[model samples]
Target: MSDPRHSVLLNTGSRMPLLGLGTGQLRGLENLMPAVDAALAAGYHQFDTAAVYRNEVELGQALRELLPKHGLERADIFITSKLAPRDQGPMAPAACQRSLDQLGLEYIDLFLVHEPGTEGLRVEDPQNSVNRAQSWTALEEFLSRGKFRAIGVSNYIVRHLEELFASCKVPPAVLQVEFHPRLAQTELRALCAQRSVCFEAYSPLGTGALLSDPVVLEVAKGCGRTAAQVLLRWAVQQGIPVIPKSSNPSRVRENAQLFDFELSQEDMDRLTGLDCGQRFDPEDPSLVA
Candidate 1:
């Protein structure tokens, strides 16, 4: 038998592959396609992208070029895109269609609200939550129309999910967040799980922090893997689907070869102890409001 495909249950009651290629900071369009090429060859069938990444066009081109080489159809792959901040409200439906046009796809496997709330919304602004809830209602409509097979939110805190759940007809199918040992997000993760919502971790390798940690290095030495692999495997073993972004070809391949071994209970405990909830993302309270 071949290697087992690791999967996570989506809130749509579907099983999505646990690992995905994240296209966050792919700077230029030219450089983006090659990384996308490498990741596809490495068996990454799921892809995570957002409009803010500004590389959806490049990502679309790569998919068109590569999937044919592997004899895979569009449905063979799972593709995700997010709704941008400016694209909120009744206009979001049209924006989702535009994203589909950019990707050259009929339907997105998943669509997300890029953040909990839009930027420039201040504290105690009752309209802030109301606006986000309204945007989510639009997303829910898209889900109904089958434009997005699944709908979710990224960078949402527990409070944000709670309010959305209270106001919207559809709860988020997934929550994509910046989670790592340093920023454990245990409570938020648990809350999503309780609602049968899939949780995805963005920046799971601690955004290069794992590369320099002495403790992580020691663990990697013992495990005979690189610090990056150690950190990724830790997240996978914890049952969180992690998308670690890497433009380097070698690192892209290395990130995918993580299903072979299980971390020991002791090592898992040690990894958990490393959490200081250190967040790499700059504080944007607008996101949590």
Candidate 2:
């Protein structure tokens, strides 16, 4: 517990950084490059991306160009990307190759199936359990080929994982999901721990919606930290990884400032009690235009 920069151990025994940067929702070289520059300067060593983000090329270029300036190398950083849903079944490995070409990396540190099911590519047609098993087969094939060090899934629930584990040869090493004080995901957390799968929290700040929460703010004030830091600290303290996205340099720097302090047990309980199963997704009115 003393090491604030501790890495979460995956089933593969590879160390995944507990705190990372999310590159979704911020496309184009203009934003991705500078935000990454700021994140690098802020001491971030991990980055999350996806094929759907449409910034793999730009992100790869930016990191390649910027790393030299900071005297860093690929080994110093951990990169995570995802396979899109449309590329389920036989298309999964091809998509990973395309992503490798886009990122220009020798091998990805971690790669995940972005979604459990596909739209229409498979005969099963958006079949959750079967598609996941099929896509996992592709991932496992490429994984042995040295395309990705560890493979996992995003947006997958308990049942999908159980089914995948039953029929697949490789077990998922990580699970990424939308998490915050509002959506505690306690059962998912328990299941992940039980299976030794490292849980990674996306939108840990609630995509800017949880920063102003009264409960979060109250806990932050007592800890003398910002709401974002409190939330990130809470997630990592629970032995989960968190990726918080921000383009503002100051805010980007501020987002990873969770290592300085520890949240009290009482404050953790208060934050835990704040969970009422609230979630923010694309369907949320506040997110729509």
Per-residue alpha-carbon lDDT of model 1 for 19-60, expressed as tens digits? 888898985757777777888888887888888898888888
Name the TM-score of candidate 1. Answer: 0.94
lDDT string, candidate 2, 159-185, tens digits? 777777788788889999888888898
- In order of listing, the candidates' clash counts read 0, 0
TM-score per candidate, in order?
0.94, 0.93
What is the model-wide C-alpha lDDT for candidate 2? 0.84
Strongest candidate by lDDT: 2
Q: Judge candidate 1 at residue 212 and give its lDDT.
A: 86
Predicted candidate 2, C-alpha RMSD: 3.8
- Runs in model 2 deviating more than 4 A are 1-5, 120-126, 283-289
